[model samples]
Target: MSATSKKILVVNRKSPYGGLRSREAIDTLLVASAYGLQVSALYLDDGVFQLIQSQQADQINSKNIARMISAFEMYDLKEVYVDASSMGKRGIQQQDFVIPVEILTTEQIKTLLHQQDQILSF
Candidate 1:
């Protein structure tokens, strides 16, 4: 990683299965990190569902997002975050997810957004 690699924040605000946005967001994150960028991802709104355990994409003939999510750490994409309020609204807890994530309040998310050199919403 370069000492001055750009800090990129990728936001996922849509449901993972509705369309390809959520998956594309994760792909973007991986590519960015692979290029030596400091990449992070924030799951907001229905996007929180993307991290839930036991996703059955096979039933729908789609790729397994949950499995891909678990690979984030291996890709060196360590700054994954979930919105606290969104999780509460959906009745999801940290233990409900397949991988570890830092839960952030909305205000904290805003602060994080401001700190990023680039922001991309998927």
Candidate 2:
């Protein structure tokens, strides 16, 4: 990696409306993309819920977070990953997500953590 290139890994470990962490994670990714950094988003634990299809935030009168996730590709962020076990636990399959995401095992996540230039969890 060049000095001007950044390998930023963002881990989203919470629900979108459960707290601010989910939104923050997406926001951070957007900012990183704007700066021309190589950004990767990892959905672990409850974070897998964020990618569930047909999320209706209008029931709670909140903004739709799923749409934000879908915009990642437009921003040139191609490295979206989700924990396989987490998705299974939440009854979410790969088909449940709008974006094509890499399903990762715990070992893979550990390896990615070591490979990243910066790791941010939210």
Candidate 3:
């Protein structure tokens, strides 16, 4: 920790295990949290599917990314957010997510980005 808490924002725009993007985003957040930084995770575009309940990665032989996401609480990293429009486009209601999350507009997301000491997008 520094003299002041550092705010780190991680943006995920891809589905988990679709490639490396979502994995890297989550790993970054975990590392930042381990260092005791204030961290937030934002899901946009296809990334919203990453938080969907009952994902079946086994069919694709992919690792269960949802389990990694569930570890956020253990790390005390709780500022999870999703894009409201994205969710609507995907037909994902609030109850569809495995975890409750703050839904924000694009403008709200921009405001959050501006508040962060660092921003990493994946």
- Report every candidate's CA lDDT: 0.90, 0.89, 0.88
lDDT for model 2 comes to 0.89
Residue 49: error of model 3 in Å? Answer: 0.8
For all candidates, the clash counts are 0, 0, 0
- The digit string of per-residue lDDT tens for model 2 on 1-122 reads 68447688999999889978888899999988977888899999999989887899999998889998899988998999999899888888899897889999999989989989999999
Over the stretch 79-119, how does candidate 1's per-residue lDDT look in tens digits? Answer: 99999999999999999998889999989999999998889
What tens digits encode model 3's per-residue C-alpha lDDT throughout 1-122?
A: 57238888899999877798888888998988888888899999999999987889899998778878988889888899999999999998999887769999999998999998888889
Question: How do the predictions measure up, each by TM-score?
Answer: 0.94, 0.95, 0.93
- Model 2, poorest ten-residue lDDT window? 1-10
lDDT for position 51 in model 2 = 86
Clashing pairs in 2: none
The all-Cα superposition gives candidate 1 an RMSD in Å to the true structure of 1.8
lDDT of 2 at 40: 93
